[model samples]
Target: MDELTRAVVQLEENQVIEIVRRELKKGTPVEDIVERCRQGMEAVGEKFSQGEYYLPDLIMAGEIFNSILEVLRPIMAEAKTRKLGKIVLATVKNDIHDIGKNVFKGFAEANGFVVHDLGVDVDPELIVSTIKEEKPEIVGLSCLLTSAFDSIKDTIERIKQAGVRNQVKIIIGGAPVSEELKNWSGADAFTRSAAEGVKICKELLES
Candidate 1:
């Protein structure tokens, strides 16, 4: 792991900012810097899965990642000419946790996807309405609490009832989301990793 990746995994916010700024000054490609950060985040996720880290740690890591993005946003904006796709993203109703959702948003945006974020504890009707208005190719639902599984299922059902389900692919994600939940909720895909979620969104579009 490079210093940037190690600093991020160690949750060293100041060092991360310093290294990123130095790298940018040294002419590192924006994509390469972002990839290093992603690698660090992936490692953090592995630690979380191993029980070496907890929810607070994940939240802290997200905050650090966001800081890094703020540093890169201007360069990224200047470099990006086209969007890969549009995604309507939100934390499902009855669940207010948004760290995972925000992290996913960062990865999605970094990968050239324009995201319409609905924020936390969003209603299914609003999500469906946004899908209709934005005409996005994908909808991404996020919830950390397992109790919000029903909200995910209900949201998809509402989309189907609204007759727009076929127009957009649905993806569910968060700590508790699984392939089984994806099946149960009528979603086309599910993932716990932000990077993996972005990959799935791409694959969904290709298919």
Candidate 2:
């Protein structure tokens, strides 16, 4: 692996920031650097899935990745990027976890989607109201607790009841999400990783 990639995979915080600064000094495109950072994060996610890395590793990687994005955001804003539409993100009612949601938010924004993050423990009524007001193309529900599945189901049901279910695609993610739960909660898609969540959101919008 290259320096940047190695730094990220190893969770070398200082080295990661320094590498990004060096790349910027060399006149490298911010997009290239952002993509490299994402590649590193993807590797982290893969290691996490394989049990090679634990929650602390994921959390550290996320913090480093967020730092990288903070460095690149201004440049990215000035660059020309294809708009990937809007996404509404939240932790379902009664779930206080935001790690996965925050990670997904970074990926989504990096890929050019405008993300509206409705912070942790968002009520179904608020989600419904936000969907009505924002009319985002994708609704991303996150939950770290298995017990929050009911909240996810209720959120989706409320969206359907609001009569805008057909207008948007719902995506559910976090530790307990799966194809079975996706079907059970009536979500259009499910992913275990934030990276995959971003990809699925893109595909959902395109299709």
Candidate 3:
């Protein structure tokens, strides 16, 4: 394995940061560094899925990936790289959970999506208004509580009522999300993981 990839896969936070900084100083391409980090994150996710790593290990891997992005974003901005798309992301009303939302936001932004995060406990009306204002291509809703399914359904219903439903793709996710909830909420897709959400958004844009 490459030095950077090995550091990331091993969850060597200090080594990862140091190597990333060194690579940046050496003028390595930002996209290349981001890809290494993504590979590392994918490795961590696989380990977690295989029960070889614990939840805390996965969280640590995510944190390391986020730190890597913090170092690369400024470089990309300096290069004037255009975003792939705009995404409206929020944790639905009455559900203040944000860990999943923040993770998803980081993944989306690192992959070149400009995410306008509305923070936790967002109202459906505000989401509708934001859609009208931002005209984003995707809206991502997150909910941790089972009860927030109603909020997701109501949010989509509100968007439909506003006549903007057909103009945008809506994706809902979090602990309680499923195909059933996707259908019930009228969202275009549902994902259990932030990584899958990113993949889905890219596919939606391409389609």
Among all windows of 10 consecutive residues in model 1, the one with the lowest summed lDDT is 72-81
lDDT of 2 at 73: 73
Q: Tell me the deviation in Å of residue 178 in model 3.
A: 1.4
Q: Write the per-residue lDDT of candidate 3 for residues 134-193, one digit (tens) a residue.
A: 999999999989988899999999999999999899999886799999988889999987
1-207 in candidate 2: lDDT tens per residue? 778988999999999999999999899876567667777887887899999999989888878887887887776677688878999999999998776687778777877888889999999999999999999999999998999999999999999999999999999999789999999999999998777788899899888
Candidate 2 error regions (>4 Å): 25-32, 42-58
Model 3 gets an lDDT of 0.85
TM-score against native, each model: 0.88, 0.81, 0.74
Worst 10 residues of 2 by lDDT: 29-38
Name the runs in model 3 displaced over 4 angstroms.
Answer: 1-16, 26-68, 80-82
Give the winner by TM-score: 1 or 3. Answer: 1
lDDT of 2: 0.87
What is each predicted model's overall lDDT from 0 to 1?
0.90, 0.87, 0.85
RMSD of each: 2.1, 2.8, 3.5
Q: Against the true structure, whose lDDT is highest?
A: 1
When 1 and 2 are scored with TM-score, the better candidate is 1
State which candidate, 1 or 3, has the greater lDDT. 1
